[model samples]
Target: MQYYYGNQMPLRLLDEAEFWKHQEAEHTEVIREALNGLEPEYVQALKEWEQALTETHQQVVSYVETVNRMGYTFEELQEQVTELIKYCLDESLKFIDLCREIEANSAAAKDNPFAKTLLNHIIRESEYFVGIARIILYGHTPA
Candidate 1:
């Protein structure tokens, strides 16, 4: 006797390639502008975070290359890729939180026109980054 289950929902694997492409195409320019408008300290923080991200990306690439050269099994490579994605997602969330903190503090700081403008830009940018972070972590595209 065959046990019947209700209508099965097709599981969609996270398409990291498509996600990255979309982010690069649609969000990079805004992020760049926001980074440009940040205060010095915030800029430094972003730079450091970006450096870490770059290193993580390089590590992933190296792992994939090594796996290809050394003839690792698909499962082993998938596991490594999953770990790298998790690490990058964690780092992205940390950067998002840092950006939020910077935005909040900047907004609360003394109000000079220039300072307010800068802070507003940071606030906007932080919100966007937070959305991106959520998308990366949860695999649900931001609306």
Candidate 2:
């Protein structure tokens, strides 16, 4: 989670966001690979998610580089980074919903227990990231 970074707080959170978004993007492929007979619609959705997550991951990485290059988190960029964290949190929540939908409605996923388990695992991981992001954005007690 790495939430406490003193002056490098934004950098730390950005690092976490980058890693998790990349993981989540890879998770879409993991779901596709785990489910042998996934519906075309579901597969297409996962592919889109992968692309989106990857783009978000890249954005976070860019922020991380900016922070490092500047040697500290400036006020203007800090606000933007905070918004980016919020966006990442929202993206994670949406990804979780998509995973839940597949678990509940996908015919191929229903036939494959491993995919279901993987989905659950992936959802939990994303939820953890959400909790961390909330802590970073809204403090220990998020509304």
Candidate 3:
């Protein structure tokens, strides 16, 4: 997973608003592909969950944009992003579980690795984001 995304832009350099927009679009595409082989009816919950993710990403983007346009600091955006990371951390666990379930049920394509790859990426990325978010929002210290 690290090799896959190693050369990507460091999140620190990202314009939060633009980053969220790109991430949101990427997520939509990835999820669409991931659900490709699942039975249509079986994907309703997944579709709804994907939509909710989109909506949240949009909200975060909008908030960051507004903050950037004004002469304001990103303090609020930090809190918002922290919350988003927490939500994503939880969702990533569920996503991994659902993929495992689908694979166990033999509903997923055996030849296509797209869904499995996406879920693994989500899990690793979520863990990284959660760690970064925690460090930023509450400094990590040796306990």
Candidate 1 local lDDT, 62-100, one digit each (tens): 664565478665455555555555665565456556645
Model 1 residue 78 distance off true place after TM-score fit, in angstroms: 4.1
Write out the backbone clash pairs for model 1: none
RMSD over all Cα atoms, model 2: 1.5
Clashes of 3: 0
What C-alpha lDDT do the candidate models reach, one value each?
0.47, 0.89, 0.51
Writing each residue's lDDT as its tens digit, candidate 2 over 27-58 gives: 99999988888889999999999999999999
Return the clash pairs for model 2, or none: none
Local error of candidate 1 at residue 100 (angstroms) = 2.3
Tell me model 3's lDDT, rounded to 2 decimals: 0.51
lDDT of 3 by residue, 26-81 (tens): 55456556656766644665566567666656665665556557634445355555
**TM-score against native, each model:** 0.50, 0.93, 0.57
In candidate 1, how many clashes are counted?
Answer: 0
Residue 18 of model 2, lDDT score? 93
- Looking at candidate 1, what is the lDDT of residue 59? 63
CA error at residue 68 for candidate 2, angstroms: 1.0
Top candidate when judged by lDDT against the true structure: 2
Candidate 1 to truth, TM = 0.50
